[model samples]
Structure formats: C-alpha cells, structure tokens
Target: MNTSRILRTTNVVLLLMGYQRHWFEKTSHRFRLSLPSVVYIFVLGVVYTACFSQHFDKSSSTLKVLKDISPFLFGLIRVQLALGAKAFAYAIYSSVKSVGAINSLLKALPSRNSQFTQDEASAYLLLTSTFGILFCFAAYIAYEMKFELPPLPDAMLGMALLLPHFILAGSVRLYTVLSWLSRGQLKELKKNAEEELRANLTKDPGNIASAIFTVSTEGLENLKTKLEILEANFCIFAQSLKHSMLFLFAMHANCLLGGFYTLTYYWNTWYVLFEDRKRRIFYAANASIYAFIASDYICLMVVLFMMENERRNFIEAIDLLLAQRKLFSKKLRPIAKDLRGVLKKKCFKFGGPFQPNIIYVSLMVCLQIIIVTLIVTVHYLEDEISLLKEEFSSTDDN
Candidate 1:
C-alpha cells in the first residue's frame, strides 16, 4: 500500500491543517512544524469570528438572527469547541512526541506487509480517503447552495469552511485506517499465537501440564516479550489520542443532533421545495448534507466496533493461555503473571472512564438515525394523518 508515501502525505496534510507536528514522521526524515501551521489556525479563527460576528448583528438577515435561537447554536458552539479541542490535542501530541513515545510506538507497530494483502489495503485506503474528501466537498457545496449566500461573502466563507472540512475529513480517514490496520495486525498475531499453542498441545495431548514444556522456553519467552511490547505500544497510542478521540466523538454527536434538528425545523420549507420540481436541487442538497453526517458517524462507529471485537477476541486467547498457568515452571509462571497483568488493563483508553461498549455505541447511533427518520416521516405525513382522522370521524358520525 506504499505506507511510507501515504504517511508522508498524511504528515504534510496534517501540518498544513493545524498541528504542532506530524504524528508519524520518519526518524531519518522529519517534517518540521513551521509558521504556516500557526498562520492557518490564526486565519481560521479570524475568519470564524468575523463571519459569526457579522451574523449576530441586528441588521443582518433573518437567517442569521434565527441561527442564534435555533439548534444551529450547536454549529457555532462546534467551531469554537473544535478549535479548542484541536489545540489541546496538538499540545498533548507534541508533548508525547517530544518524549519519543510516538517513535517507540511507531517502531512497535507490526509490519504493513502482514497477512492483509497490499492491494486490499490500498483499495480501502483509496476508498476511504476519496469518500471522505468528496463527502466533505459535497457537504460544503450543499451548504453553499442551500444558504445561497452572496457571491463575494459566499466565496470567502466557502474558503474558510472548506479547509476545516477537508482537514477533519482527512483526520477521520487517518483514524479509521490506523484502527483497521491495527486490527489486522492483532488478528495475525492472535492466529500465530493460537497455532503455536495448538502445536504445543499436540505434542502432549494426554497431559495438559506438559504442553508448556513441549514448546522451547526461548520461543515462549519471545512471544511473551512481543505481547508486552504490544500492550505498551497500544497504551501509548491510546494516550496520544485521548483528547482527540473525545473531540471526534463530540463532533459526530454535535453534527447528528444539529442535523436532526435542522431537518425537522426546515421540513416545511424543504417539502415545498420538493413539491416544486424546479427547486428540487435545494431539497436534494439539503438531504445530502444530513446523509453525509449520518454516513460519517455510522462509518466511524462500525469500524470501532469491529476493532473492539478483534481486541476482545485476542484478550480471550491470552486468558486461555493464562488459565493453564499452574502447569508452567517458575520461568513460565512469570510470563503468565505478566499476561494476567495485561488482561487487567484496558486495551484502548478514551479519556478516563468513558470507554463505551460497541453494542451501546451502535444502539445509540441507530436510535439517532431512527429518531431523525421519524421526525422527517411524521412531519411529511402530518397533513395526511390529519385528513385520515377527519375521515374516520365523519364515517363514525354517518
């Protein structure tokens, strides 16, 4: 999949977006954080403040006035919140990198040339990067069309908005790529561990206690060391992403909530547009905005769910190995003890005790979609439902 090339591209893009430094830059060839990163963030802040400040003016359009009163308040809140979160995360990321944690973690990562085919990985990378970029652009176009801002201001706002959309979309793609690739690596490791265990057990089928002895102590210790390193690296990765992951979760939630409210509030206007074939473009664009939001949210939730599933499966394999600890000699018992310690720890941390199970997260996402759907459906059918009730009453009278 040309991992080095992809990594370089990602580093360049991230630095341009707004970061103190790139996360996975090569040791031999580093990309230094320069003045452009700060300038970009500064420009973004100025653009956001200038745009919103004008919108808040009493003489401005009704749309601007209404934005303050509506759920679009979240839209305003999100920009500021995102900027703050990004800054905080970048600070943390920079500190983590300064201490060499990032480099160590990068080194600990399994080879890209594992069991997952390069062609398949490349396809996924291409698909995700393309979809994220296109979706962001589509959302921007849809927003611009739906709002119908004046030319100069519209162009300026589009420039301001488009950068963040593209940058954040790229960030999301990067996260998903890492998650799935790590999942594949973990899966490969688990498979190898299982095969080794099976082979060891085969040599002593009648005596479970003798299996550990059948495998060379050196081989067992090597596997133990690998797991130890894996656990440490996984934790470092999670720690590095602690703030950023929370920010992403908040962003997805804010978008979904804002989108749902926006759709419901504007349904009547949109329905009118829908009824007019000539104005259907407006309706289609508005719908696409929400579609992009829902799709992004669901895409993230599904990938994380799959990653968690693989993590749990791997943990269970380790647990099975630990279960036969009494059979191991003193040398191997220490390995079992360390494995037990790893079991006690969380694989991924998402800011303190906020770790959510996949089922809970999936259900919450599903519920949001269903609720948004119902809101649109009920509003669309409101007149029909009223007529049906009137007809039933008249028939009863008759």
Candidate 2:
C-alpha cells in the first residue's frame, strides 16, 4: 500500500509538472498570466465550494430542488441553455448544408476534382477572427479569478484527453480538399466504359453477338448511365468524416471539463455547508461559478476559430476540384434531399463499421483544450469580476 501510494504521488507530481510546461510553453507566451495568481484563485474556489455545499445542506428547500433534478437531466438542460436556439440552428444548418454541398460537389465532379473545388482564395478562412476577438472578454474574467481554485488538475485532465479531436478535424478538412482526385477518377472511368461499348458495338460483325452487343450498348453505354455511377455514396460520407469527428471531440471535451469543474465545486460547497460555513461559502461558490462560466465562453471562442479554419480549408478544396471538374459530361443534377434538425440516425448504423482513426484523437485534443481553458479562466478571473463590473458600469454611465 505504501509503495502504491508513493507511485501515485510521484505520478501526480510528474503530470502536474508536464501540465505546467504546456501552460507556459505551448500557450502563446504573449498571453501568459501569472502562476501565483492562478494558485490563489484555486484556493479560494475550494474554500467557497466547501461553504456553498454546507449552506445548501442546511437549506432543506434548496436541497429538495436540487434532488428533483438528476445529474443527467441537469446536464442536458445546461447544455441546451448554454447553446441556445441560434447555436442549435446554426449546427443544423452547417451539418446539412456542408453534407449536401459536398455530396453535390462529389456527384458532379469526376475523380481528381478535389483540386478545382478547393476555395484556396477564400478570405473567410479567418471568418471568425473578428468575432473571436470579441469573445476575448472572457479572458478578462479569467485573469481576475486566478486565485480562487484548487490545483486545476481536472481541467488539465480534460484538455489532455480532448486535444486529439481538433487535430483529427483539421486532418479531415485537409482530406476533403482531395475530392478533386475522386471527381477526376470518376470521369475517367465513365469515358473508358463508353469507349469500350462503342468499340464492341462496331467490331462484332456476327449477327448474334452484334445484336447482343448493340442491345446492351444502347442503354448502358450512354453518358447519363455512366455518369450516374459518380453520385455521392454512403462510402463518400463515411470517407469525408475527418472534420465532423473532430467537432464531436470538441463537444466531448467541453462536456467533460464542465462536468469535472461543476462536480468538484459542488463537492467543496457541500463540505463547507456540512462544516457550517454558510455565507462565506456561498460567496466563494458564486465566484468560482462566475469564473467557470467565463472560462467556458473563452474555450468556445477557440473552438469557433478551429471550426472556421476547417470551413475555409474545405471551401478552398472544393473550389480547386471545381476548377478541373467534369462530373456529368452528360449532366444530371440530383435534387436536394429532405433534411432534419436532429441527429436521429442510430450511432452505429450511421457511422458505419469503419474502424476509428486519428480523427478520434484529434477531437479529444480539442476537448482537452476547451476544458483546460475554462478551468484556468474561471480559476483566474473570480477576483477581478467585482472591479470589472464597476468599470463596465462606469463605462456605461459615461
């Protein structure tokens, strides 16, 4: 037991050191905040969490309300509330449009058409650069709360797990650019099939073979028939999954990080309430919660940046493919299919049996970044919020 305990302690120390390295090194040094400040915030958050829980325990009415909502239900509600209707609508639009547009681009495009459709000239790759800057207000909050929490190990854990998701999504976006290859190949194959039919029709002089070849060639050898083969297949959707998967990773990471922070905060609050630390604990809990909310906002802004990059990269690829594109030498456009708001497809069936790839890892990484950003932001910003609010009010008055 003693040996096991020593090993655990050593492992934690090493992990903590590694995390600190990333925080200082990987995070742009220009944005680096003070470590001492962060520690102070964590300590405060811990004390507050403890007090809040103690108060809640004493308040039978509040305890009853909390008990009425299960963890899973509460989590779902929180997610829905946080995202809002606009966010959900945006998600639906993006998912449907991107999928359908890619499908159309693939169907009309021959193999090797990825080069043409790729919109390399797009100024929008940094689509949210301006918008993202606006969200930096969250950082102001993070900076203030830096002294109220514990080790922030949970945030670190979340980030470590989710970083892979971002990379995976980015990789997939890169692959989508290669659609030109698919378009080109599709075109070449159809042309060959047509040529073969024509050749056989002319050469089979024997009445029996000639008649047979002519009948078969009449319908099958036509441009429309051959072009139909290039329609977007489920296989294509499965193949184009790099970015969406990365997105999923980002979601998972945020959820985990949020959950961990909430749980820890609640646990501490409960402990404090049990210890009869009422008002002080409530103040602490509120501070941590406010900081956490700010941090989450910041992390989401980062995700917006990643997603923007993916979209820009995708458009450029499509435009590249579009340039050399020749999908239906005999044109036949597919009508738009009905779309839905919900992700109603059964997970196993929709995703298909393809083994998971680096996309999964990429998504996980994005998740980790989001979680860590929130934990740190919330931990750092709690203290400054009071003065910040006053400044905001003053600005408003002026």
Report each candidate's C-alpha RMSD, comma-separated, in the order given: 7.1, 19.1
Residues 57-176 of candidate 1: C-alpha lDDT, one tens digit per residue: 455454364455443343544463455446444543543353354445545454343344664455365335445655665666566466565565444443443344434554455455
C-alpha root-mean-square deviation, candidate 2: 19.1
Model 2 bad stretches (over 4 Å): 1-142, 145-158, 171-234, 240-398
User: Candidates' TM-scores?
Assistant: 0.65, 0.25
| Local distance difference test values of all predictions, in order | 0.54, 0.36
Clashes of each: 0, 96
Worst 10 residues of 2 by lDDT: 333-342
In lDDT terms, which candidate is top? 1
lDDT of 1: 0.54
